[model samples]
Each structure stands twice: as structure tokens, then as C-alpha cells.
Target: MSDNEWPRQLPAPDHGEWHDPPQARGRVLLAAGLVITVLLVAGGVAWQLMSNGSSQPVTQPSAAPVASATQPSVTPCPDPELTVAVAPEMEPVISQAAATLKPAGQRCSAIQVRAEEPGVTVDAEDQPDVWVPSSSAWLRIAADRKHVYQTSGATLGWSPIVLASPAALTAQYAKDGKTAWAGLIQAVTEDRVPVITMPDPLITTTGLLSVHGVHAATALTTKDPGIAQLRALTLRSRLTEAAADPSALIAQMSRQTDAVTASFQVGVFPVVEQQVTIYQKGGYRIPLIASVPVDGQIEADYPFAVRKGVKAGLAEQLRDAISKSAVTAAGFRTQPTAGGARLPDSAAEMLAPVKQWAQFQSLAFQVLLLIDNSGSMNEKIGAGTATKASLLRESGASAAELFNEQTTIGMWYFGAGSVSDPAHTEVVSIGPIAADVGGKSRREALAEKIGAYGPQASAGTPLYQSVLDGIAVMRPKVQAGRPAVVVVLTDGTDGGTRFAMSHQDFLKRLGAAQDPARPVPVIAVGYGPDANMNALQDMAKATGGQAIAARNPADLASAMAKAFLAARSAT
Candidate 1:
């Protein structure tokens, strides 16, 4: 959706009666003032309404579920089937409710939902019959004379966006009780904090909402500094619009060595839940908490509007079913609650509270570091380590530490050779491993194995064949939903498979082998000058993973850590 496509409906201009603070003062003063105003407004409204003995009139249902005559007519039914497009974040709870509705013969299907930035036009022109936007602002933008339906409730609202940090890093702020939105902005703008956010405003509704929340808070406080600082930070943040799915965004955030910060709405529960599961398996501790701004809150309303000329009966029934189910089963409140409910089975449970960092040190991640020891790895580069073996030995050790495993580590190194020649190519399995500097544990163990090779480098890289063999070795140990990442450190291209299949062919087969419900993410680390960066990137991109480049020993550790992070963070 583009800004141009958005319907024009700007908020009324600010009146001079509102204060305008200098941009240098940041958000604190503004936020505090806004908080006071909100409290006053809320209290005054309650008192006035109670005394007047008159209540605010509830707005009539905006529009009825009537079909337009010009559009295709749907058959009228006592109960018409309805489809609701939902963002992936809301999939679990929404789907759960949908599943339960099956006994009623209500056709409830959860379509893949895309969240457009407020004021962006979604291509719902010919897609789902109903569009359930992730936020209230987006709903207002998406609706027109052509598409109008009743809003069930605000799905979730924005909390004061905070920089999610490790407990150690944020302990001071917690102690100072400075975890408010204003505090966060001050910390980030002053370079006192390290935070992360998605890069693109157009793609991530959460990011846009976060910005809007800050803007709204600033507007209430008459503070311009907070807005300016936020704008500056947005420019420097490593956010990118490249992530195509929640899984990709999760993967990218999980891999970061720095503190992770993101703008998330209520719909992100599924992905958050998955993160919690992984952290628990790995024995890492982190708390995920939602922070509400002291000032007026920013809420997201998920609207389900029937397209024009849809069956009125069906639309109405479907809307009723969705409204009833969402309120009862989904973690949504018809109106704001004093505090949000913690999902007992949510990924957010693994998250530490705002400005807190919990150590993720206990569990060890088991990684199968598959190095391409084929002949092409020996190609000389302009400068730097030319051999793939040297690169693997140098890089693999540091990569292992990023996951900080508790037990067994496995390793396999292979080159072009028939299975008959065990000496030429071999698969070596190391400890339920301990972390070592370079060649002791699984990562180092494999590095050592490659070091011992007598340089009988094969003619080609059996990349796909190696991965297949590695997967077989790894498949047994991987727990359901715990990530099983295969970091393929390779040079050149995949060749020398017993079967004449391309890398894509191998990937297709691998994908087929996994349960469609759960798929393993594969990360590719391309090393040395001749490494096929493009091919590796393509492989990683295809699997919703990352393709990183490690040109030298210095870059290898970070790259390896990043690769592991990307792979593990994937939902």
C-alpha cells in the first residue's frame, strides 16, 4: 500500500492552547504533562457523566452488511460463510477460535493478513471478502463507501515503545523507574541506549504504530525534541523492510548481539510465543513485558469489513461469530483493561520486563556446522585466507560461542568422493558438546578434523549432498519446534551429488521431508574470495534464512554469530 492510496482524513490542526516544548527537552516533560492531562480527562469525564445522569450516545452501526447491486450478488443465506483476513500474529488465537466454531457449521477460515502502514492502500481490491486490519488507524484508512463493516473491538493498542534489552544493560533504568516512553526516547536519542526496530515504515504496522504513539505523546506534551530524536534514531537503526514475514523479522531480531527493540501490537502473540519456547529449550532467561504510555494510549482495532455486494446474511453472521469468538477466546478486550493479561503459553512469557535483561546463558544450542571442503575452496583470492578449510577452522569456533550450548555438539566435514571411499570423505560426530576456543568441542572438533585433512581436495563441492547427510544425522536430536539450524559454510557452488540434482532440487526435497506445519531454517555462510555468495544468499533467502559473508577471520565470528542468530530467531 502506498501513501497516495490512503483516503484523506487528517486530524484537526493543533490549537495554540496546547503547549509546544522545545525539541531539546526530549520526551520526559512532555510525557509527564500528557499523562496528567489524560488522567484529568478520564477523571473529569467519569465525574461529569455520573453527575449529569446522561450517557454518551453509542454510535449507530456504521453500515449494514448489505450487498451493492452493481457488484456480484452473493446468495442470501440464514447463515452466510465468512472469511476473515488476519495478520500472522493473530493466527493462533483466531485459528483456535475458528477451529472451535467448526461444530456450529460456521465457515471460519483465517486468511494470511498483511498489515499496511496507516494511510497505505492494501490490495484488498480482489482478495478476501473481508479485511481485518491490525490497527484502528489502518482500519479507518482501509474503509470507504465501497468497503464498510462494523468493528468488533480494538484488537490491541500500542504500548509506549521501549527498547527491549538484556537485564544487565537495563538494570539501572529499572532501578530509576525510568522505563517510560519518555525515558526510552531520551536514552535512545542521547545514545544511552541500544535498541532495535524494523527498518521500514511501509511494511511494519507495529513500527508505524510505535512512531505514531510517540508522535501522539509529543503532541500532548508540546515537545518537539522527542519527535526529532526518534526521527534521527530511525535513520540509524539497522531496520530493513526486507523481512517478508513475522518469522523473518523474528530471525533477524534474535540474531542481534545488541539489545532487541521492536514495535509490536497484540496480534504478534504467535511469533512471540514461539520465541519463548525456544528460549525455554535453550535455558535462556528473558522477560517480555508490554509498556503502556503514561499519557493517552494508542490502540489498534482489527476491523472485519465485508466487501461490497457480499451476501448480507453471511456477512452479518460471520461478523457476529468473529466478534463473539475474539472477545471470549482471543487475548483481546472489548475495552481497555487495567493491565494486559500474560499469555500462559505465549512467547512473550520468555521476555523480561521493560528495561530488564535476563541472562540467556544456561542452555547450549546444538548446531551442525556443515563446511564445504570441496576443491573449489582452494581457489586463491586477491588477498586473505584462500582455502575453505582454513576459513572454517578460523570462523567455526566463534560461531559456536554465540549459541553458548550446554551439551553435545555435532560436526561433519565432507568432499567429493564416493561413499565407498570413507577415507576421502567422512562425517564426524562430536560431543553433546562443550564450548571450546577453536578445536575441542563440536565446532572446534569439526575445525580440527578439517585441519587434519591431507589436502586430497575433491574436484567439486558436494554442497547439497553434504546437507542431506547432515540433516539425517541431525533430524533425530531436534526437538519439535526447537530450531535445527544447518549453517552451511561453503565456497563455489553445489556439485557432486550422487543424484544429478540442482541445489534447488535438493532444497525442494528437503522442504518436502519436513512437516509443512513446521519447517527448519537453513543459514548459509559464504567464505573466502571464490565463495558463491549469490548462490548461498539465494539458498538462504528461499528458506527464509540469511546468507552472510565472512571474508576474513575477523569477520567470521560476527558473521557466524549473526547466521546462528538469524536461524534460531526464525519462528
Candidate 2:
């Protein structure tokens, strides 16, 4: 339900002061200082990753990234050593416990503590023996993408994802009542709250929470018109240091604009509950108020999960050491221990589509679809097999059958031609898939065009020239945050004599024209057994994309979809 659907907003929870009790304050200051120091260092490193590596492709870990991992990246010390990957805020508590875990007669059992971002641990080649993320969403997303140990880690403590905005901004939109995602989105749509920011989804679990909550409270499903409104709002952001903590964004927002003025509505940030606590304790350059949705709740339930093959008794020993409930800190809220529970795979799969929706809101996907009209595409399989072109026609035609009205599509079919005169033809110009007035839907038109598509006028395969043509068309569509890609469906390599540029010139052109900041991943897909995988792979890697091979023509649809999502969102 929306904000207006409910009469009143729930009272904001009253939080405690940000300091330790008088009795313990004096004794633990040094330890608290070290932990806080580690947090600061971690923040700096994250900022660097954002500024420097934002353009790099997302590389999967080489190891069995998912199944049968031994332990996280650390070896056992001669003495008993347990390496624990803890969220930055929980480092001190876990580290303290590590100091005391000695085998009955042993001198010490070292807990090598590493302060990692929410989703980083899952990527460790040697999976961290224990995975503790701020929110279960991280663990869940990691599992959906790969086969992780798939266990629900223990919840050590809780941190809700809150909206940190100036009192004036909340009053403008949410005053006289409570604000929920519905209200927040309404305000944004009409331009009441113009400046809103979120951290990078890859680096902060809070980012995922904000994404999920916004998705849940508003659309609940990507199919809702509400998603379009969210997409419009996402396109208006101006904050930087997207991979860093709330501190970096808060500091930056302060300098950009403070409380509401004639020109500014206070910036609304989706931040961790602890960051709000830190600000309320009074070190922030700006003052802020925290708000959680009345109907929708989002929290980081720091889960301590164990990997497979952990010695029979080690998982329990680690779980006990991390989430004893007796162990609490000022910034964190102590919660009851949640034993070994796992998010069901079926549920994770159901929720996974919303993530792609969220990514699309901030990341625009501009893709050019290239279909081969070569004679080979017309070849039928053994006796009963349909031609590759026939399969493409069937899949492309089914788009109109789905409830989803996707972004505009540009469809082209290529064959033989030179640099001066390209061998390709545009079946559908690059434009919105739906027309403003009466016209057969682009989806329907596309399906018809491809279904009837036959071999090119000649039997030549102008694969090289067509690739260059595709790059030219997709390059201009690249934008920051929104990724662009060129997807090609082909049955064979270049056999035509229309190749204009030397293989070197084509390489040099793509290399020099490529923009790391707004990379256009050209995903080359080889359909059927005769297609050249090596040629396709080289083109894909050169443009920061991938080449996928499928032995059967019928599987091209699924393969193309996979390549589309990965190429556009991988970086």
C-alpha cells in the first residue's frame, strides 16, 4: 500500500546516545578508536575503487567461484588461526572475540580480521570460511548469481536502511503525516525532492536495500508504472564517490547544498542506520533526520555464514564466537541469534528480476541487435530441424506476447559491403519500440521482418564489415551510468570479399574509438556448430564484452538474452 493508503506514519524509533556506558567508556576507548580508524581507511580505499575502476569489466573469480570452496583467502597459522571477514562496523567485536579463542592448551587462536565491503567476500577465490554481510540481500544476490554455500548465516546484529535528509525536506513532502516509499516517490515525481543519492550497489549492501525497498514499496514488481517514475528520478542524480561510504556522499552533499533554500531541497540519501547514528552523535558537516518507510522495512541483518568443508565442529564454534548477543556495540543494535537458516533458492529467483530492474533505472541499456541474413542461416537441421533464421523469428516475435514493453530496439541484418558502402540494412531504425500513434508494435514488426528474413542478395558473408557498422551505430549511444552494447547473431565467419579495412585498421578503429567510461560491450554470439568461436571471442574481448557459443540453433534465444544482460551491466 502507498503512503496515502495509510492515515498516519509510525513514530520514528528513538535511538540511544552514540557513546559507551560511563563504566565501560574509559576502558574500551582505545579499542573503539582502532576499529573506527579501520573504518576510515576502508572508506578511503572504497573511494579509490570507484574513481579508478568504475570502467573496468566485472571479472568472475577463477576458482570454482561457487561450489566446493575450502576456506577464505588465508592459510592456517602453525598455531590455531581463524580468519573472519566482518563488516566494518562489526570488526571490533569480532576481532576482540578472536583474541580469546585459544584451543584448551594453546597460547592464542588469532582472528585475522578484514574489514570488507558488503558483497566482496563472496568473490574471494578461496571463499571466506565465514561470510558476514551487512544484509541478507548480499548473500542472497551472491547465491542467485553463483552457487555459494547457500546457507543463511547467523544474524549477529541489525542495521536498518534509512533515509537521511534534512528536516525541511521531509516537512515539504512528508509533513502532517508519515512518509513511505510511495510518498517519497510521489515527491520525487513532482519535483519536490530533487536531489537524492545512493551508494554503488556492488560496494554497499545498503545500496541493495534501498534498491529493493524502493522497488517493493512502489512497484513491488518491475511491471508497475511506478518503475518508470523511479527510472526518471534516478536519471537526475549529481553526487559522486558512488563506491564510498555515506560519509563521503554526506560530506559532498553538504558542500553542494545544505538545508533547503530557494534553489535546493536537501539531498536525500539511502544510508545505513549506523551512519545516521554517527551523524546524530555530531561529527557530520550537516544536520539530518532519519526516516524509515511506514509499511516497508529494510535492515542489514549481519549474517555470519560458514562455507562447506569447514571441519565438522568449526562452523558452530565460529557462529558462537561472532553472535553471542552478549556482545554489543554502541553503533550496532544487538539482536537475538538467528541459527543456520538459508534463503530459499526459489524465492531468490523470484526476487532477482527486481535487481535487474533496479540496475536499469540508473543504468540505461542501449543495444543494437544484428541478425545474419547469410545463406548458412537458412540451413535446416538434420531432417526435421528448423533453420537458425526461423528460430530467431519465433523468439523475436514472442516479445509482443510478454507483458513487458521493453526499451526501444534497433534491428539490423547485414551481409556483404565495403567501408564506403556497408553490407548491412536496418530493419527497424533506432527508436522507441512503441509508436506514439497507430502502427504495428515494433515487437510485432520485428518478428515479422526476421521470420521472413532470407539469405542476402549474394551468398557472401560480410561479417567483418557488418561488425564495424554495428560499432559505429552503438558508440554514440554510450552514456555514463547507462551502458551500451552490440549483439550479433551469426552462423559463420567472414567469407565475402567486401572487407574494407585491414583487420589491423578495424582493430585500431575500435581500440581508439572505445570509451572506457561509457564502454560499449559488443557481444558476438555464434549459433550452430560451424560458427567461429575464436573470432567472436576476440571481438568481444577487444570491446570489453564476451563471446557465447551455442551448438544448437534453438538455444540462441536464451544465449542472446544472457549476453545482453551481462554485456550491458557487467562493468
Residue 325 of model 2 has an lDDT of 47
What local distance difference test score does each model get?
A: 0.44, 0.59
Give the alpha carbon lDDT tens digit for every residue of 108-171 in model 1.
4333233333333353453455555555444433443244445543343222223333333343
**Per-residue lDDT of 55 in model 1:** 57
Per-residue lDDT tens digits for candidate 2, residues 515-546, read: 77666778888989999788788888898888
Candidate 2, pairs of clashing residues: 72-127, 72-128, 72-129, 152-341, 364-482
**TM-score versus the correct structure, for each prediction:** 0.35, 0.46
Candidate 1: C-alpha lDDT: 0.44
- For each of the candidates, the C-alpha root-mean-square deviation to the true structure, in angstroms, is 20.1, 16.0
Query: Cα deviation of 267 in candidate 1 (Å)?
Result: 21
Q: Please give the lDDT score at residue 415 for candidate 2.
A: 70
Error of 2 at 345 (Å): 4.7
